[model samples]
Target: MRRLTKIAAVTAVMALAVTGCAKKDTQTSSASGSSDKGGLCASGGSGPKIGLAYDIGGRGDKSFNDLAAAGTKKASEDLDATCKESEAAPDEPDSAKEERLRTLADAGYDPIIAVGFVYTPMVTTVAKEYPKLKFAIVDGAAEGDNVTNLAFSPEQGSFLVGVAAGLKTKTNKVGFVGGVKGPIIDPFAAGYQAGVKAVNPKATVEMKWLSDQADQKAFANPPGGKTAATALYDNGADIVFHASGLSGNGVFEAAAAEDKLAIGVDSDQYLTAPKDQQSHILTSALKRVDVAVYDFAKAFKDGTTKAGFDVYDLKRDGVGYATSGGQIDDIKDQIDSYKEKIVSGEIKVPNTL
Candidate 1:
């Protein structure tokens, strides 16, 4: 819920980084965590060296990339590790990411983390070349002896937020704005719609994808997010939920302007959103990328690291809904009841429509 410190994803230009090489534009950061409320993140000792590559939005997107940054901070605290990072440009090709990964690897950073699924190819290819080094990809898959996949059941969290939206909607009309439509994003839309329909069968869910395929720009375009959410609000949706990365910032803007409510994704956006937009955020679907990232680092440090998929589901507390701004206080118990049912197998939350 704390306001984030990472810079916002406002431009397409970023600096390149390597451990031994000179940094351009100073985009690289010595991995650090968001402020620890009680100063709990004080460095304990020297630990592992980390290399992080962010998604297009990078850190400061106040959503996905920031959460990944939080994970590095956590790792820095718990493991007292040193970290270096590089970001992706707005429309840069995959080659750019591969080069970044190569530089991090070349710099001798162990257990390097790639912050998005787009890095699957790079990680799969790069990990093969660096057999002695460790690699992990968030929301991606790759075959290698040193690669691990940090995946999450984000649909479960989306379902929880959808429940909030469904219970809170005044007009019985809700909308979902997806940054892109694909295997990773489809579940968000499906779980949201399912949650809405589950609570209010008569409710109508207006769904739209900013992009039709696996386009990275869809998640970066705040203007598109605003336009999509604005149109939905104009069509009578009183509440909207977005799974559109940084673009969701625009959704919050539209919601505040239209005097409507919105649900955020990845992080507890209510705490990080601008003061004006804070009141309008119903809640955010919590995807604990931070925990997963830290776990991967810990595994690597402890020498138990393995190459495979690590899935964080609702039962694992890896996914849930936020409760900031007290917008859904009265209905929290109702949402918890649904969560219990889901955990107990009483309610089957579909990952797809």
Candidate 2:
């Protein structure tokens, strides 16, 4: 729950200024001023206008973006607020991101939320331009007094799920599929590797990345994910855990086809993937992005929005592993024991490999 005083360098991408207008207009909607959408206030009542700029694959990702949408959905219903959303392109430029933020700010939307780390530079530049508007960035840090950085300890959650994979792997061979190789995903690899080593020191963890960088369409590329996961499975990896965004769908598909186990990330993917694939999902590393987004939106509406750095970690219950399939039920007690140790400061999950 402690706020990060400084953001560790996750990547070396330079910040670029958007000199002209951003191309393309995203879809927008007014969630309030309609039928009683079930809120503290009646319908047709106006409230804060919220805007969300999502990363690649947006809502249907059934992963990170969808989880973020769950938060906005809750806000629109509970706070009776109007909401609008935008999606990022596969090879979106820095200016395009900046333009998206600027468009929302200029349209009088307060407390705009940028859903991924790629928006850090854009958030920094745009927050300065719209001094009065509040902005929040997930998975990365942004400067200025008007910006709130909503980050989570993803490694911590992935570590717990790694414990699950280690416990359940009959073949003693598992795999990790990363969306893109960088500091952003290093924690997942590091924590998962450590967790597997912790439980089964001899277990082999095959690591493969879909893309070398963020703009290579790795997170949104399902075919690439399937290929990577299939290779791992065919090579005798019985359980594969993925930190890719929409690309994880391919991992799940591969798992289902091969009758292998797969661990999900960001959301309870067992509930999001196709029904046939649900049985193959052993667990999911929960990032609770919905909670962060919802909490920030509520705080902004209540006039309690704090602009600065904030982090949600294990101690705050912001990250953990999900057992939606009950596949880990036999080891539930053991997993909780590890969770307790993490929360009690007995275990330090590494953030890099």
Candidate 3:
């Protein structure tokens, strides 16, 4: 529950970074595991000091950022290390992101992790400047001598939930609401469509996007998500799946209003959603951000961390569907069978529509 501090300093550094002359800050937060004194994060310890910079919507999204935080927190606790965290400012320039990275690096936090794809460019530029600091970028890849790219097969997990939607739907029609239309988000829609067809070829799948490419607000616009999902439900869709980050919160609300089902993405929404809306969340497509982040931090501490691309896919249990509410109990066997096929390469989940 630690919050980002020194906003004025961060804003100043961001401005300076844009001009290529940002001065480093010497201040540090308290250590992660320690409750009192020394700071939120201190430098030069036998254990690692990890820095986690979250994507837009940050920790309270109940989705992606929360998962990232959970993983980093677990790793820090396990190693008895300090973990300083930062969140993205809405529509901030790429330079601001660089400043955040610089702030973490300057404080001697090694194995820094950028928690979203939006950080690819910033990470690319900053990782070069901090060549000695170990870095990891989730959901995107950036090359550097000390960088590790953590990626997941979103399509693989989306397909499993899609199967649940397909089998559970009384109406043959379903819908998908995406945060933005792009390669990053397309896989979710694609896999959901593929799974629907696989389960029932005649089932109709409707796809919609909350915002077009370049509109960063898409991921945070819950109202837009609600409106879109509501429209789909009103149009006769009994089930809806979303890959809309925090925006997906609105989708859950829409489902409750329409008395329909929703499939969550990135985390187990059935468990995270409000108690009233929890039942509407049939399942969730899990990307296991926590697991990846924890592994990266632990590996770095063990001195076995390596730089380069690391892909997490179905075979590695990096992505899957949650069955928290037991709403999908009847179809669990079917979904499990398909999961085996996916892992064994018997089924090739489509990454694109």
Candidate 4:
């Protein structure tokens, strides 16, 4: 459900001097001042001008990036704010993200929101240079007097979905597919395994990562997600949960092809999935990035944005499991009970394996 990523190997990706958006017109700002109806900030926002930097795979991933975009939409309506956006290129180095931030700042965007931990260092370094422009990073540990770090308790939510799989699996075998192998993604696996074991101590969890440190496109490869999930299903897992970003698409595909159930991450994927595949999605572990982004936008507008962590935990309703498809309706009480225990400190879900 999140990326509390350890330091990304930015130095590993050779720096590219290319400074434009992964978008067609990287420098173009879609302001509400313009009459473009499809513009991101079209809600008649009259507040701060925001610069949003999306992680790789951009807005249509139906996972992480899409969730952040939703927050932007809500901000435009509620805070009367406007925003310009830039997207990270697959496997691009930190230099590109830095340029994206600088471009936004140069064009007068304030309180920039960088969507993932891959941009953490760049935000930390760039915020120092801008001094006055505020920044909020989702899942990043970046720090500065003007930067707000918005982190979510994905592990807590993962545990609840794990309960669903444990309760629903006919084969007593489940699967977990993470986008990458790192601290950021480990919590998901940890929480899921814990939850599964909590309900069925002997159940097996087939764990796989689409990419390791050697590969940076971990979050972008849908084919890899499909392959990994297919193997898990072939190996006897009746339900699969994927915390891989865009790659989770393939996981859904695999679920549909195999006629099995799957759990989605970061957003209510059941709402975003293809019609034929919707029924295959049992639930999604919600990271609520939109909620965090809206909270940040509101705080920034009111001059109350916190400098340190803005945690979205179970207690804060920041992270939880979604029940949109009515698939989990029968088990809602069981799931909520676990959710309450975590919120009440009776259940200590692990954030690491």
Best by TM-score: 4
Candidate 2 residue-wise lDDT, 1-353, digit = tens: 01122344321100001111112222235432111222221223266678788887777777777777777766766676666777776686799899988888877788799988888888989999989899999887788898888877787888898899889999999999998776677778888888888889989999999878785467888889999999999999999999998889999999999999998888888876778999999998888888888899899988888877678788887788887878999998888888899889899888867
lDDT of 1 by residue, 167-249 (tens): 99989999999887766777788788888888999899999889875456588889999999999999999999998888899
Worst 10 residues of 3 by lDDT: 9-18
> All candidates' TM-scores?
0.87, 0.88, 0.87, 0.89
Query: lDDT of each prediction vs. the true structure?
Result: 0.78, 0.78, 0.77, 0.79
- After superposition, candidate 2 runs with Cα above 4 Å error: 1-45
Candidate 3 on 234-320: residue-level lDDT in tens?
Answer: 988999999988999899999999889999988787876789998898999888787888789889988988887777788877888
Considering lDDT, which of the candidate structures 2 and 4 is the better prediction for this target?
A: 4
* Global lDDT of model 2: 0.78
State the lDDT of candidate 4 residue by residue for 170-223, as single tens digits.
999999998887767877888888898888887999899887752345888889
Instruction: Return the TM-score for candidate 3, rounded to 2 decimals.
Output: 0.87
At residue 261, candidate 3 shows an lDDT of 93
Per-prediction CA RMSD (Å): 8.3, 7.7, 9.7, 6.9
For residue 156, give model 2's deviation from the true position in Å.
Answer: 1.0
User: What is the Cα-based TM-score of model 2?
Assistant: 0.88
Candidate of highest lDDT: 4
List candidate 3 stretches off by more than 4 Å.
1-46, 214-216
